[model samples]
Target: MHPENGLPENSPTTRVFVALAPPDPAKDELARALGPAYAAYPRMRWNRIEDWHLTLAFLGEQPVAAVDLLRAPLAELAASRAPLSFALTGGGHFDERVLWSGIEGDLEALQLLAEEVRALVREAGIAFPERRLRPHLTLARTRRDDPASVVEVAASLSGFAGTAWRAARLHLVASNFGRGPGPIRYRDVASWAFRDPAAGGHSR
Candidate 1:
């Protein structure tokens, strides 16, 4: 609400985050595996497969102008780093509510990348709460016994181990969350390919 006008203020801001998306094949495999769960747990708010991503830094809501300041720096950072290899292996639930699939492969490298990403966010003068990074793809959420059965669902995928794929890009995304919406949706603001030494550039 605009206090001065006593009306809604339409400030241009974006709910942005930095993340890495899984390749289509990897996501498809996991989707197939969850076919049964999709039927059995219809009540749980399952995330659209296209929306799955491993978030590194969530900058909450920032003025569009401020977010623009990050573009070139992130691109340069992407150019200096190489794509990472990862696999979707196993599953777990957060606090018996939110369901997620765990990550596998060089976690140390992933952690380092996440750290560097956060550092870059800080350097951008964006303020976000600091928290330890736990890499996972958010699969679904249950609001309490909206299905207390989430535990069973998580345990069911405990041994899921998908084949490995490279994390090829650095994605800056804007989300339509808490915007008087149905399911939240996301759109890519910009993405930069990781440096490929042989090509001397990224595919983006």
Candidate 2:
């Protein structure tokens, strides 16, 4: 089915995911930490700072109609949850192919949130493979010919620790990766701010 405007089955589908993005100041701090790696490993495919996010659930490709069904339920979920506090710390590589920054602080809360998001998608009848949650922010990727670069860069970021920030919103994002030429681009399809119970479920 078409995933764009939910016109019909002939319309294009979008790759979607649920996530939390760091604020500009938090992202800037991480950018500053990566300055040296950016210069040293110019060949690495670095993700754009604006695209940096901590994924809560990857919904894969879904029809626009199906994705639309998630909005109301997700909004209700967000309204029941409070903001989470977290910080970006250290770095790691996945099989020396993808470089990522680790997450710290309030991990238990983060896991619970991820679980709830996945449950909501499933309850909506969306079928996606279940995978364990490993919280990390993808930073860059290394080419097959130069596998060592990611390892070196990851080591350089061992002591890097970003400032704490409250994750206030849950975002439904659409990506066009591997669907066309040029770099992958991401845009928000929907978002909801966390509601504070003490404040009468009002989003701050």
Cα deviation of 16 in candidate 2 (Å)? Answer: 0.6
Candidate 1 matches the true fold with a TM-score of 0.89
Pull out the clashing pairs in model 2. 3-64
lDDT of each: 0.84, 0.87
Candidate 2 lDDT over 1-204, as tens digits, reads 245532234545668899999999999999999999999999998989999999999988877778888999999989888889889999999999999999998789889999999999999999876778899999988888999999999999999999999898999988877766455677888889888656874432
**Whole-model lDDT for model 2 versus the true structure?**
0.87
Score every model by TM-score: 0.89, 0.91
Any idea what lDDT model 1 has? 0.84
